[model samples]
Target: MKFLVLGATGATGGLFVEQATAAGHEVVVFVRNPAKLTPRDRLAVVAGDVRDARALAEAMHGTDAVVSTLGLGKAKDPANLIADSTRALVEAAEEGGTKRLVIMSAFGVGESLPKGSAILRFLYKGGRATFADKAAGEQILTASPLDWTLVYPVLLTGKPSTENVRAIDLAELDRLPGLPRISRADVAAFLLATAVEGSWSRRTAVLTTGR
Candidate 1:
């Protein structure tokens, strides 16, 4: 599979690139800073911003699937770059005839999952602006004609892959008290698996440790 990964320099995106390449797939990373990526035989690094549709189209040309792990460090800011960038990516993919897109979103964006205790929610809600932005991006992808899967994970941690993750639907999610966190590597694995197997196409799933 030829894969186009946006946010390749990001923690989750970088893990996706490494895992995808190791799986013997051709991976192209759309990045603004090429120096951040180490050169590898199976990985092609394309230096460009996600807002550039033409450049994205060029990078996405002949790609089998696209994955976005784009993250904004400051969630309190009013700007929503992910939403903007993903809209551009949708256009580029549509024009380029790519059908599959897998994007990362936080767990509580569109669902009523009680992802945190009262205190945690109160603390996290400071970034409501950012969550709303991600929610908008998700809406765009959901409405598009492409086969898309939105993988919403719980709070991310830097642990190793346990490979014990499970996908829960909205109903199951609401009953849980903030889904168990999984490693970035496992998240990457799930995304790549979804792309290859088309396991969760046209659906939004929350991923977490099955604990």
Candidate 2:
């Protein structure tokens, strides 16, 4: 399958690119700066912002699916980024006739916030617009006519791939503390699997590292 991966310069996104290529899938990456990613076979790079629908649509051409790990890293205002980018991606996908999408989201965003501890909820709420934007992005996906999956992972680490990941429903957020962290490599693995198998279609999957 062919894949258009957003945020391919990120740690987990880089892993997704490498792993997806290794899995015998064609991978296309969209990035503003290509220096962050090393050139590799079966990996095509399209220089552009995810917010640019025309550029994104150009990259989306002939791709079988899309995986967006587009992260908002301490922007002055992150409230509109993911939501707006998601809107652009959805439109680009629709225009290109692509159907599948997998989005990487954080634990305390959207409906998952209600399932977290009061302290966690308080902290996320303190962020004001960040989580709200994520929720809006999620709503966009849920309301779209495409096949989409939202993956929520808690406390990401740079540790080696454990390959042992756990996914639970929103009702099980209390169990999160027990499984506090997950490796980016493992997160990449799950994302790749989601793109290929579409296992969690139209669902939200909260991920952790455990058997």
Candidate 3:
């Protein structure tokens, strides 16, 4: 399968690019700085910003699917940042006729916000702008015609993948049974699998580490 990864230079997105390349999938990564991404077999780089829909659409040729790991990146008003990027992505995907989309979202963005622990709720509330932005992105995906899966992961970690990941419903978010931190590698694994396999289609899945 072929993939176009947004924000492919970030930690989680970089892991997706590496793992997808290792798995023998063709990859085209859209980034602002192509120099940040090292050349690899089966990997192609497209230089562009996430907010550039025309560029994203142009890069979407021959793309079997898309994986977005976009984040705020030190923006003072993060809501607009995510919302604009998400809108551009949705438009580009539609224009390019790319249907499959797997996006990484925060756990506290939408329905899961009220179900979080005290600290989690407090943090999300404190950072409501960012969470609201993510919620807006989710709304866009929800309304789009594309096959989409929104994976909402709790606090992310930098550990290597154990592949012990599970996606629970948002209704079960507050009652999670194990550690809340999920490794970026595990998240990448789940995203790649979902994009290729089409499981959990058109749903909001909360991703977390499980034994």
Candidate 4:
């Protein structure tokens, strides 16, 4: 499979790139700084802003799926990044005749906001702008006709891949315990699997390392 990846230089995105390329899938990374990623087999980099539909459409060629690991860098960062990118991504997909989109979102965004744990809710209050942006982006995605999978991961960590990630439905929110967490590697693994296996299409799942 060939993938067009956004945010491929970030923590989770980088791990996804490594894992995908290692598994023999062709990858095309859309990044602002292509130099950050070392060239390797089955991996290619295209330089551009994620919000640029023209560039994104150009990169969409022969892409089996599109994966995004985009996230806010800081609380103070402008929150429009994800929303803007999603807008462009949808347009690019429409123009390129691509349908599959797998994105890494947080557990507190969109419909899952009120279902977050107490501590997580508190943090979200402090980072409301960031989460709101994600919600806006999710709105744009859900409105589209494309086959999209939204993985709302809980608090992310840098721990190695445990390969024991669980995909919980929003209806099962009450069954969850305290603030759950999943590693970037695990998130990457699930994102890759979700795209390649065509699982969880047009659905939103909460990703946790817990059983």
TM-score for all predictions? 0.93, 0.92, 0.94, 0.96
lDDT of 1 at 161: 95
Q: For model 2, which pairs clash?
A: none
Give RMSD to native, each candidate.
Answer: 1.8, 1.9, 1.7, 1.2
Per-residue lDDT tens digits for candidate 1, residues 1-211, read: 9999998898999999989998899999999999999988799888988888889999999999999999886555848697889889999999999989999887767664364545546655766788888888888888899999989887789899999998876555545453357788889999999999877888887887884
10 residues in a row with least lDDT, candidate 3: 171-180
Rank by lDDT, highest first. Answer: 4, 3, 2, 1
lDDT of 3 by residue, 92-155 (tens): 9999999899999888887887676777776666778888888887888789999988889888
By TM-score, the candidates rank as 4, 3, 1, 2
Per candidate, the number of residue pairs that clash is 0, 0, 0, 0
Pick out the ten consecutive residues of candidate 1 with the lowest summed lDDT: 170-179
Which candidate number has the best lDDT? 4
lDDT of each: 0.84, 0.86, 0.86, 0.90
Best by TM-score: 4
Clashing pairs in 4: none
**lDDT tens string, model 2, 1-211?**
9999998988888989999999889999999998888999899988987788888999999998999898877675785988889999998988999999999999988667767666666667666577788888888888999999989988799999988899986654554553368999999999998889988888888997776
User: Who is ahead in lDDT, 2 or 4?
Assistant: 4
Off by over 4 Å in 2: 122-126, 171-175
- Model 4 whole-model lDDT (C-alpha atoms): 0.90
